[model samples]
Target chain A: MKNQLTVILAILLFFGTAGFSFAVKPGEQLSDPKLEQRARTISKGLRCVVCQNQSIDDSDAELAGDMRKLVRERILAGDSDQQVKDFMVERYGNFVLMKPPLAVNTLGLWLSPVLFILIGVGLFWHVSRRKPQTKKPIDTDETEHRLEEVLNKMKKN
Target chain B: MKIQPIKFLPVIILLGIGIAFAFGLRNDPSKLASTMINKPWPDFTLERVIADQPAFSREDLHGKISLVNVFGSWCAACVQEHPMLMRLANREGVIIYGIDWRDTAEAGSAWLEKYGNPYRKVGLDANSRLAIDLGVTGAPETFLVDKNAQIRFKVVGPIDEKIWTEQLKPMIQLLQNET
Candidate 1:
């Protein structure tokens, strides 16, 4: 019974993790492991034209499959990673890249996080400066005297 | 109570975000700006899709203003746009060249025969190699090439009467007048 349960759990786990596997079919894989790895890396960086959000490596679209093949073809042809990316950009524009290059058009997008953090820090400083301290220092002697009076009253009661 | 301008900041931010979303919702995400605009046609030598029709090459586009239409026999949208293309070819006398994208030559030739062939010449792009170079995302995409072979404009979807009368016809005339 335990063995059967383990087998079932293992099957479930395999099916659960299957969606995260690379979309590269066995036939599409290169003969050389090194070239295949390079192809995968390049595919992960390119956005599928038909399915805009998913990378070519993750997309099941026909265009994505074709793009993956093209990536491997370019690599086999001795084109460098940058050259492959440039080749895609020449046809599909910079939109084909998963992460767009930092250029004049993308300056605002690249700098926005730093801009937001600086704004937050400036707000923190300004608010802290404007806040008046409300906490008063306690006088130990007065507290002790009040405590003594309270003790005497309690004793009389 | 005197209204403090700072107190309305939430409302202002809400209004800004609402406006931004309204504009974003109006725009279609699938439509991308053409990268081939103002660039010369990419080089390709393609075989004739049909035995009777003439074959087309990149060099053929250089001497005339013409429309390069990417289509596939399997695509339903291509069928839907076939009538408009026929009208344009017959009535407007627009020179149209076809790229039968990602389809078998037999299928493409049959499709052209079934729907009245509107193309002056049809190129068979069985592997979609030429289509990819042309940056074709889907079938039935059309490009307006000037006399110099520079791609002037691209229409993503099927061109209707409005697009033809308002945009493409005027552009064609303008290009023809250019000395």
Candidate 2:
């Protein structure tokens, strides 16, 4: 029982810290919860230009914080979510978007998964088709014939 | 010993992957292409860092080939690139404007005093309003604007002597020749 309690406490501590680490500071959040939520959602889709991999919402970089504030400000100014995203894309290009839009440049990136799947299926089919030929089962009649000949030789001996 | 094209597929794929990685590894991920290139410079009105100087705006850049430099007193790389900018403005007679990005007016003024000021006009960008519009990720970025007020080229990091002589010099000369 003590061991189980300790394990539970350890898991709670791990998850509690994880959640606390990624949260935006109270000072930066908007007064209206709905607008703040919208800002959070929008920020999650923006790539932090300095951090490269982290979304603006998840980054502690000063630039990301400023971007988060900008998102809220835009939201307050009656800009739709799409408009906010477009605004960022206009300034920083599509690289600012965490989810890259389907466009001429990103066609290869979007289609590569399907291409890979088709290639994988083709290889599997080719291998399976050749497998049966190499591992052909012995004929029952041949096995029986060989057994009978062995029995006859034993009888003669 | 059958010479089958299919047998070479693995080798070809391996060689292709190796070549891709070789080139990809050499690429600097931090270097982002500015979307504002060839686009008109974003509109902004900024107060002058120095009290006596007039404010800076897009109007100042009109009919001129100018270098707009973004620097911060807090940024170490900007310190490293200051002498090169001084040479360009003082020696080579380049018209350079300044944006003291994400810094206090007091700090910006003090920094200019320490490092010899090389700007025709200096604007304070305490809130990064202009920096964001220019797609600036960090400090020590420089933009070359043509006579038409279009941003022609951008350098992300600190510019050194090699970049000035090789890339920016020829580009500036080319833009100057254009009507």
Candidate 3:
């Protein structure tokens, strides 16, 4: 029981510190909750380029904090959600958008998996169809007659 | 025997993957693309680093090719690039505008005093609002603005001799010619 209690305490401590490590700097909030919500939604879709994988909303990097504040400011200034995204893109390029739009640059990235799956399915179908022909048995009578003739020739020898 | 095209499919796929990896390896993920290139410099109004100095705005950046350098006392890289900036200010004809990003006014003023102030006008970006508009990821990023107030080039890291001579100087000449 004492060992189990120690394990539980260790788990709790680990998680507690983990949570602290990722704690993002709180951005200035707008009084209008609706606008704030829109800001957050936009933030969630924008990538923190410095952090690479994390969105600005979840990243603790100073740049991410600045970006989050910018999002809020834009929303408060009455820019629409699309405008906010466009503003970020204009400053940081398409890479700043967590969900990159389907465009010429992203066409291959978005479609390659589907293309690969189709190719894989086609190969599988082709291989499955060829299996029966390769595995088909020779004529039983011909095989037996050939064996007999060979045996007879062996006896003559 | 005729070679079937189907037999070459694996090879083609492998070649495709190899080409993709080659391009991928060539890309540096850490080098963030500046989307502000060729766009007009973002408008901003910021106080000067010195208490008594006049505030600076976007208007100050126009009418000449200027180097707007984002810096801070807290940034170690800014120190590394300071001498080069001082040299440029002394030797070059272009104006160097400074944006003190995310730094205290006191620290920024002191840093300039100690390291030597190279800027024609220094703006204090205490809140970093203008820094975001300029797409500054961190301290020590520099943007070269043409006479029309358009951002022509952005350098992410500390500028040394090589960058100034090879990249920046040529661009400055081109912009100068356009004027």
Candidate 4:
């Protein structure tokens, strides 16, 4: 009886924690079909707030879903693409977009590759200006002495 | 051989700039865009549909914490995400708005009846002018605005349960505390 009670209690505890941990919060359903389709397309461009490098469309994050629904609502309400981006940028900044805007805030993002090319060119200049050849002077006296020492060592061996 | 410091000036400067720029591009924990703690929402005027009329201007959304959704009836993914929206409507303190992008009123309304009417107010983007302004290159984007009428969070795509648990909840938490 004691063992059976313990097993039942353990099972109950496991299920209790499991139920609490993954409780489902039923989200608002989107009724407008047009708005829903619009949600998919916009999500493709927007970055996932949770996952790095993942678009909201591709992400499985909970926020991504809300965002999709929110986008659909905005579209239904008649916000344009730029307006939506501006809205998000105003809140989250340009990092939310996979493609950052070409503005003062993101100037370096668009120019760094060119900057790297310029650095490469400058490095090339430094490398190419080097002398083709430099002569090494011979130490004849040391050579002669070493040769004598080697011969003597060889003879001894 | 000794290296001349003057000759290395350009190289040093380039290295410094490259390093500085690279570091700047990095994703800083404290500066994540979506995690922006407190900021004013972006200003926008959306075309709305209320009481069987043409698009009405969404000027009244300024002072409320509201959601702006961009969607179209013809989109397939929108259908997939509909149930989730229905669920979100039941959550606390979320004011949902809708934008019907280029769809007929009959189908839009019918779609709502089928999934569930989650939005408090609805709009119609028959001409897509609002979409252009919002930088909506495609369908289905969402924004969360604060009580002071600033957009605080954005999500793009059809929603699912996982996304709600991970990304949406945190943003909701932030928005909830901001009030």
Tens digits of per-residue lDDT, candidate 2, A114-146, equal: 987887798788777774446668899999999
Candidate 1 regions with alpha-carbon error over 4 angstroms: A1-20, A130-157, B1-8
- What DockQ does each prediction reach against the true complex? 0.52, 0.61, 0.57, 0.09
In model 3, pairs of residues that clash are: none
Please provide TM-scores, in order, for all candidate models, with all chains considered together.
0.84, 0.88, 0.83, 0.49
Ranking by lDDT: 2, 1, 3, 4
What interface RMSD, in Å and to 1 decimal, does model 4 have? 9.6
Model 4 residue A76 CA deviation in Å:
27
Fnat of all models, as shown: 0.60, 0.68, 0.72, 0.20
lDDT of 3 at A136: 58
Task: Write down the TM-score for model 2.
Answer: 0.88
Residue B38 miss distance in model 1 (angstroms): 1.0
lDDT, candidate 3, B1-179, per-residue tens? 99989999999999999999999999878778888899999888897788888756788887899999999999999999999999999987658989998888899999999999899888899877888787777779999999999999999989999999999999998888997
Candidate 2: list runs displaced more than 4 Å: A131-157, B1-8
Interface RMSD of each: 0.9, 0.7, 1.6, 9.6
Q: Candidate 4: which stretches are off by over 4 Å?
A: A1-129, A132-139, A152-157, B1-64, B91-93, B162-179
The TM-scores that each candidate's chain B achieves against the reference are 0.93, 0.93, 0.88, 0.66
Best by DockQ: 2
Best by lDDT: 2
Candidate of highest TM-score: 2
Which residue segments of model 3 deviate by more than 4 Å? A1-27, A31-33, A133-157, B1-12
Report how far residue B106 has shifted in candidate 2, in Å: 1.5
